[model samples]
Target: MKFVHRLCVLCLVALLLPGGPARAQSQLVLAISEGTSGGLDHGRVIAKYQDLANVIGGVLRTKVSVVFAREFATLESGMKDGKFDFVMARPSDYPARGMRDNGYHYLASAQPDGQCLIVVPKDAPIQKLEQARGKRFVMPEQVSYMSRFCRAELRDRGIDLAKENVQYVREQAAVTFYLDNKFADIGAIASYSGPARKLDKDGFRVLHRSVAQPYFPLVAHARFKPEQIKAIQMALVSLPDKAGGPEILQRIGIAAFDTSGEDRMNVLLDWLEK
Candidate 1:
């Protein structure tokens, strides 16, 4: 009788995995949005989340896999296809449209809103955005949330790039290097890029700083049961207290999982719809 029950459980898990489950463990896919913030190494980015996934998997008694779609369109399509059981997306790519059009549930967010900095040499006299105008600019690629948010804010402040030499690189480190080497007059870097350390150690100064803004959000698909979702939420919220949790959270730069209400999502969706 016990053997029969074990066989039934294996059968159920087999139904969940692609190509027919060869293993008894249930598989969960945790998808991360592709960005330059983690550098261009896809393997490194995937590995970082694998540790977090292992903890979540241990909590849920399942196998978790981490993946990132290389392009926005691919991520959108994968969401629609229900390829991801959970997702970690940038603010601009909040999976808002997916939440409405598809069936994703807002789970939690990484605490402490992100900030952007317009940095120049510490010795440079550029004290404000206006002073940096018409100067050579260096920034991450347009696909980066850092670039998208910072660039929009820069334009709103009347910083014209058409008149200045602008260079977009694939990594945030490149932006700092360009500024440090005197190749660019100013650099736009996100707080996630470790801007504070760069400002202090690299001899750069903030010419302007952006208002606090929402950072990345984590979400789950409709396939998760309410109780299962709650369990996952609880696990993430308590991650900092678990063994080795502090190290993992620090490496990921998440202070804690803010499992607050959905008010933030509503606001984010409203902004996206507009």
Candidate 2:
């Protein structure tokens, strides 16, 4: 199973890789829109993906803003009515990405990248997702992707989840207690939480990772003029690790981030429509 997953990821990356040829000029106010509790809040989600924008801003000497989706439905209506410029929303919010595809365009990561882990107490017998059925699954208050992420595993195992097989608990400490006290068979987590120290390396093992998409991307909007888009693209293709990106990734937890690929997230679009 692990091998199959790895193979899928590799093939996807290979297919979407960006070709050689650097864009000249780099300076633009690329905005980032993500999913959160309220409507598109570009102000709040900035700190996270801003690591990339900061690097781009420094190297190219540009400005950027981070935005969040407004109640999910507003994704399409919002971007269309106004210019969002750039966004990093979820795979589930692909419709807004598409309102500008084809001649209209957008970029998304090859990975269905979002972090949510089903963790159990360190010394538990749940080594695989199959063992998680009929057991409690604790998640965060705003974790909406659980069903989409965990569905395939359930279907594969033939687990009957229709009759409340999985109980959804929303609380921070509740999740921690469930995992730490052995109350929860599984819990989901954001990958940013401390690596060895936070996740209690000694306590738990990751049974499954919901890495079906690339980490939410720093994508360009359709309205961006060619030169403007090129500048942003150049910055992303070359981050802290790249010569011109200006070093900021290290200050944050990010080791480095770069992409060479097609600006297509259609698979996500197809899924969102379903």
Candidate 3:
């Protein structure tokens, strides 16, 4: 009886140890924050990311669940609290902050870095960025991330938006509307946005484009082991080359995943803050 009791106790200890059956069975949560305003519904968001989550789970040999973080505050707070095991989000700055202020590790960023396009009517005489000074401007809502991104880029070019005549709109389409109707001289829109994509067809031109920054960054929590982190990173970076990879990329709206944005991510907050 004594030997049997000792054996049972040893077995119990073994099961409780790290990487044991109990630990391996645990599920990790992946929080996705596309944006606060004008994001997909919960069901659609899950549908979009479920396959990617399954791929991650397959690589880790553990179950991965998806959760949508609809608000920036919620996403930021969750990262700071280490509530998420993995995070893949856009507007890039939030994920950048997750790495800097919160204890998260960079995994990868979506391909085709994001840029703020300085748009103007095709017939407009503003051929240079310097010529944009004192011109009327329209941009995404004042509090939105793109607005901050545009402001930072413009600031670097010596165009202080605080002094410029500006109209803040709720949507990128409205930025173009303001320009089309002669309500604004120039506007800022994200390079990847739909409105920017149709600029040429709509008789608009990009007067200037901001330096590209990492877009839609994916990060892992600090609790991830170095080997585990490397495995996850490798899995994501190679996703586009794998079977069903192209479809997944199409669903996620990215060309491919790039793991080389860590250095740029580290300095992102500094650029935005300044």
Candidate 4:
């Protein structure tokens, strides 16, 4: 009888111990931010990171699952609630803001820094920035970094924006479309935006280009252990050179990974404030 009682207690203790069958934990969750206003398919975004999740899982020796935020607010709330172990966010989106608000640490940035440009019809003969003062300007909606860059550059250059006719488009590509069709005299777009591609074919000249800024970055929440953060950072910065990494990075629109400082991110935030 005593042996039976002892066996029951032993079994209970084993079940209570760490790594026991009864103590199974949930898999880790990796959240990717969606800050694009429109023209983004949520499923595609989630699928893009699925392989990335697998890579991270291999690095950590644990299972990892990927979740894509429906939009900016969803990502912001999730980060504040500590729902994500890690996040990949755009510069004007959750990464920098979340780092300031939720103690997220910078892990790595997508290489080939981002730049914004003001473009005019190739034959417009608008050689000087002042020549665009009274032109009809088409820009992306307010949420985009391109929009903010355009506004900041105009303000800094002492251009009287109030004197010009400005229109906001839903997508960056639309800006080029409008400019190409003569709906607007000038347009603003990101250097790599769809419209930038039409520069040669559709005929547009860059009137101004903003200085380079850090690309989208991956960041980790403070709840992560130091070792975990270090491992993630190392894995990310080495992705460009890693064997299977180039393909993944290309699919995600990243040229490479950067371990440089986050100062450029701060500079962008400052522009946002201005």
What C-alpha RMSD separates each model from the true structure?
Answer: 5.9, 16.0, 4.4, 4.2
Error at 11, model 2, angstroms:
57
Badly placed stretches (over 4 Å) of model 1 are 1-26, 37-47, 54-62, 68-74, 90-97, 155-165, 194-196, 225-227, 251-253, 261-274
Please write out the lDDT profile of model 3 over residues 95-132, one tens digit for every residue: 89899888799999998999999999999999999998
lDDT of 2 by residue, 1-274 (tens): 9999999888777656543122122234444444443432455456555666565455445555444564556555555654455555553334335443523344434232444465677778878787777787666553455444444334444654454335555544456666677666677654443432366644666776654444555555566576765666666555644763344454333454434334334454444234
Say which candidate scores most in lDDT: 3
What is the per-residue lDDT of model 1 for residues 8-92, given as tens digits with 9 covering 90 to 100?
Answer: 9998877777757554335888888744344545687676788888876877788889887667776788889998888887743
Least accurate stretch of 10 residues (summed lDDT) in model 3? 33-42
The candidate, 1 or 2, that scores higher on TM-score is 1
* lDDT scores of the candidates, listed in order: 0.75, 0.52, 0.91, 0.77
Native-to-model Cα distance after best TM-score fit, residue 105 in candidate 3, in Å: 0.3
Candidate 4 error regions (>4 Å): 1-26, 37-43, 160-163
Tens digit of per-residue lDDT, candidate 4, span 114-221: 777888888887898888877898989875667877787788888756567999998888888898798999888887676776687878888888777766777777
Please give the lDDT score for candidate 4: 0.77
Compare candidates 2 and 3 on TM-score and give the better one. Answer: 3
| lDDT measured at residue 225 in model 3 versus the true structure, 0 to 100 | 92
Provide TM-scores for the models. Answer: 0.72, 0.61, 0.89, 0.84
